[model samples]
Target chain A: MNDTFKKLFSPIQAEEALKDRTKEFLAEKTQRYIGVRVGKRKHCLYAAVCACLLLMLLGGRWVYFTPITAISIDINPSIEMGINRFGQVVSVDGFNEEGRELSSTLNVKYKNYTYAIEQILNDNNIAALLSENEIMTITVIGPDGQQSAKILSGVEACMTERGNAYCYFATSEEVAAAHESGLSCGKYRAFLELRLLDPDITPEMVRDMTMREIRELIDSLSDGGQIDTSSFDNRGNGHHGHGGGHGNRRRNGRAEQ
Target chain B: MRSEQETIRAIEQYSDTVRRLCAVHLKNDADTEDIFQTVFLKYVLSSVSFESDEHEKAWLIRVTINACKDLLKNFSRSHTVSLDTIIEQPSRLPEDYRDVWEAVFSLPQKYRDVVYLHYFEDYTAPQISRIIGKNVNTVYTLLNRSKQMLREKLGGGYEYE
Candidate 1:
């Protein structure tokens, strides 16, 4: 085996690629020590890029264990969360004013995902929005994808345990409302269901509509999913003659169905 | 810095050895070229003095192994190569030796290193231990494992050293 292996090893000497590239390969390997010339500059750049990329590749895994993490939620209130490896809150912020105010007050750095969100939403003013039946969306994200999904489910469970139907609501009602009214999961879908209740109501007006206004809309639709459109004149806007008000209004105006 | 004449002489004398060592271990054309260039560049720029030609050759072999290891660690994982990749448009190596070479390359890196150094480069297990930074016992164990693996891969027809 040894003699045969030695005979075979002779072919390892047959290098054809390095035959003509001797001068060029040497120029590349030693060009840094020699000097910087025009031709060598591109080689230098390529070398620098490769070095930096290798360093980044090595650093990428080490960075995963790093204690600091950031999570950005893109709901309308759009909160950005900076968290630590232990799931402690570093900071909570939002791009919008409402998100900023809610995140700033009742602030504690070391807290779990469930408690922090519960406290923030429990604020009197924030709770007032939900109690008054306004449409709001809260998305919870953590530092990375795995962490984000974990935090999302955690916060959703926390809200549900408190009997707060305000958050974590993707029941058949919302899904059915979405299907009937042609909307999806977020607040926009909720707005469509509200649209079926009152044709004259605009999005701007929907925001200011009290819980009573929303509840009446919900009550008007019996098990059949039909709205009584008769009470539209009594409370507010009275353009009630045509239930076809959906045709001209910008929201669902193009009733593509 | 060494003179240009010295650089040319070293390249002519040792480039083939360096290239061969790299090929036997790496089996990748691009990687073999890298080690080949790196060893020659070190010869050109190195300031260390050797007591004799034998000393210089040993030093070159050690550096070649170290450079190959460094390049390999930088990779996310080791990539395997078929013997056909090495014998592209082949000019030598009879079919019997070719099959053994393929079996050698397919062994895990640790075993392959000692086997290449022992059988191909004719380094003893103790010499391989010093060059590869492994213990003497470890080198022997690796060499044994390598022989068994190669025997299995090549259907146990070949004899061991």
Candidate 2:
């Protein structure tokens, strides 16, 4: 019975056409096996490209908004402008009450640093002070890098037309110490000189004093002698001369070198 | 999913055995083709690790039988084969082989799997019990009854034991 049954079933074979059809069905169902792999790879590539673009956008925003140099303008209103790598003023901060009022009136945020300084000098109140010979000081404070030198040069060029304006570069350490005493960079330099002469002056005494008042105090304390201008100009690499003689200020572009 | 090479190799090796199991349970070529697709496609997608060639063959047989039974359970589709197709199938065989084939298929569905696995495939009752998911003693009864039926149909001239 077993031999007979084997012979009976032996003749039954699946035809080539049936096997071929079934293979075609499986191939269709499984996406030819390669399509799935290629699809997954394409998805991964798109995700990678999107991540790269997002990182670049975030990095670009950081680089554009971060300040590399600060320009402190002190006449009576002591205001500081933060300058980015591209020379744009990204921030405006006032060190005194009058400085805050002046900063609020000037629409200089996001403008080029040179343009912002020109705007401040051209402000009606500031222009009136300059005409009256109220000593105005413009200080560039940052690391002693090429960017700082470039900023100082730009500031010097901007101030060449004004006789009493002084443009000096100071180190970040000097400026940080100045901020601790609640003074702008220019006022801080004057305070350091005043401290040497009086040794009893406090930051509060000169906190609201005009730059002209501070300069007059320095000149008086020096006993009509040549005040050592070294303290005023920390980085003496560029533009280091003093506008001497308070009353003899006709056109002593003495600080223009 | 399995790779293409592995699936094709499995198709080439087990397609014949699957067809025979389909023949034992199904009535026509369309149903047989369904069993083939279902069984082989399952093999491709399944991650089962086979111990040997025989293990793979038994797995295919079990899947094919289940596929055939599921197709038959669908009452919406016709369960009967046409007389013409039935006649056409046996006409290709020699007279003695044709008689045996007819006698085997004429048995009930429950007896056909046991008779095919025991007599043709030479599986012991325990192996058939494991493959078909039946009790061993039940498989023994089925094999005995199927042999008696085949002998009665083909006439008591051969040793069916």
Candidate 3:
């Protein structure tokens, strides 16, 4: 067996073949994520529109208005309609019941957090609707507890499925007016009557959760029961045997570097 | 700001070198490919800009080694393939060189990676050290230990000189 091994083992072009296979594998994997390009372009369009509106609204007063506008934009715009779930407004490609034009955009806000909504828009798949005349209905639930509704025109759409708070924005006449009045900018927007779909749990929360926790949560959901937490040590000192700790340390070290 | 196509081309150009480095360290095709893809993907996502081809190449090697270590951790029974199985697959290498290649493949993954980088990839100790994120002294020691292991595995038949 030893002699056979020695005889079979040689330095031929195995290295080159291995290299070629590696390249092919990488090429194939990269192509899967490359489709994000189209999404990115759409996001750029949304961002451009938002920036344009923001610029117009703040016109000649951008530097002075930016901070105030930033603060006024609500942190969490989502309404948790149920336990561990929330709702968001999505614009689908269809006509309203009245046959009047319908358009949509996501309205997401998460408490005590802010994200670059424009970047999020560019990362996901969103369809554009036709119809020169369309309107989006926004109902603002003010922080001080007053509710107001308005019709928004020239609305663009985007989506978000994760977070303790919603992360969405729109650029419409109503939204602009709300910002101008500075009364409705950061207020909650309810879409219950519009019958929008529930917002997806934010990726940030899922990402923040430990792998084991997520696995357990998924398992519990699958089995329809409370998860077993006895195995989970609050100190995070569970005996992972070999490799786990070392690997985590190395990964964390690299991330820090 | 560089286009994705430009980035892909640059990565493709160094694919072979990166693979060889990974193969040497991993001593098997499966692990090597995993490391190779990971390294390239990381490069694509990173905001760091490279000054030149040399800098890019160095970065690729470094990232490849780091990725290899990462794979070693998550490497479950399901993911690991025997080095013997990888060697037995008849593909490109000629029969005469098969012995040397097999011997290299049989070396422990750590030693194999260091030797491949130093000898096959033509990297000096300092460069290998940087790529592997180890000290220069450590790299030299690893190379020496790896050469001893290779010589022992090759037995009396092959001559390095």
Off by over 4 Å in 3: A1-257, B1-4, B25-35, B78-84, B89-91, B156-161
Candidate 3 on A1-257: residue-level lDDT in tens?
A: 23343333323232556445544655555564453465578799999999998887787454322221121212122111100011222211112111111112323332111222333223232111112111111122212211111111011112122211222233234445543432232232221101122233223332222223333344443444443344343422232121112111111102100
- Accuracy of chain B in candidate 1 (TM-score): 0.83
User: Please, what are the lDDT tens digits per residue for candidate 2 over residues A159-204?
Assistant: 8788678877788898999999999998998889778877777787
lDDT ranking from best candidate downward: 2, 1, 3
* All candidates: CA RMSD (Å): 22.2, 9.9, 30.8
TM-score of chain A of each: 0.39, 0.77, 0.18
Please rank every candidate by DockQ, starting with the best.
2, 1, 3
**Model 2 residue-pair collision total:** 0
TM-score of 2: 0.54
Give iRMSD, candidate 1. 3.4
> After best superposition, candidate 1 residue B135: deviation in angstroms?
1.7
**Clashing pairs in model 1?**
none
lDDT score, residue B64, model 2?
Answer: 86
Model 1 lDDT per residue over B12-34, tens place: 66666677678656756677777
